[model samples]
Target: MNRTLLIIAMFCSASTFAQSPVINNAEIDGSGAQYQGNLGVNQAAGDLQQQANARAIAVGHGASATTQIRQRLRTVVDPRIDARSSIQGDSFSHGNGVLGVNQSAGASNQQANAVRISIGTQPQSIDDSVLRQQNVTLIINSDPTDSEPGYRQIATSDQAFTGSRGVIQLNQSAGVGNRTANTLSVRVTD
Candidate 1:
């Protein structure tokens, strides 16, 4: 009986270790309590492109050709945050905090460019010139300021915690031919 119990325990422990751990894409806290700290988060990218092209041609007298080009680009930034109080507690006890959530997906992001060309003529003149240049600069300052806060500070603070909170959330997409979708939100429940 002792040997059998030992074998079973070993098997259980092995199985537990073999199971995969739970992983989440975003940060989340379940504890219902006030948080005090300074948060500086930065997410940036250089360049991104998504394109598709199709071409069909026929040179004979009675020729038929078909061409189709389809392109799709979708970006979803959905963050699920739940800070509800399970039992009636001090839900508005948040203190002075500095939070900065900067999400700069890409500088020169090109998406959903589809081109379809069909030519029946034999001879034609073609001239093409393409020049691309991109430059991006991002600066963020979270220093405490005793002076009056402007619209930028108020907007960022409103989305974060309550009380005297100085938060800065900047969502920027610089350079030419940039396409992006950004979403930032913070909720406090009582």
Candidate 2:
């Protein structure tokens, strides 16, 4: 009797897994408007609001090179203008929200010296009212480079002009090194 019950349960689980689930009241909508060339919001905030209601998920199991990638990318354009003109954006947000990336890895390796680079930026504008109550945040994490790499380098720069409500803010940082042997080498290549 126990063996019979186990077989019955296996059949039930297999049947349930084979069926596709349904979504109630499912639909998709999109619209656009254009005015003077530069002044229009080709993609409206309300449209993005609708899409953001859905949960987003990405999963990579095993070797990513051997697996499939599913993605959604937005391309916006004015229908009244030339057919070839359009703006494709990989990132967009309104008001404010958080963004993040998390990476974890297990390793067993040996290597020679290597060179690589990663770059990014975020530019924002807020009303004086909102700006007064908040401060912008910037973060950079170099992980293996931040810790293990002996030759560390960092640079920061700023420039601003005066005129108006009598307020100004500035911040700066820089790092430099001179030529050395084993630990940290700073060579001049000209």
Best by lDDT: 1
TM-score per candidate: 0.22, 0.15
Q: Which stretches of candidate 2 lie over 4 Å from their true place?
A: 19-190
What does candidate 1's lDDT look like per residue over 1-190, in tens digits?
9999999999889977785632211222222235465543333333333222222344443333433333343433212211111112332136444433333332233322111223343433222211122323232335455433221111122323344354323333323234432222222222
- The TM-score obtained by model 2 is 0.15
Candidate 1, position 166, lDDT: 41
Runs in model 1 with CA error above 4 Å?
A: 1-35, 45-95, 108-164, 167-169, 172-190
When summed lDDT is taken over every stretch of 10 residues in candidate 1, the lowest stretch is 78-87
Residue by residue across 13-115, what tens digits does model 2's lDDT show?
9977785621111111211111111111211111111011111222233111111112232323111111111112211112122111111111110111111
What lDDT does each candidate get? 0.32, 0.19
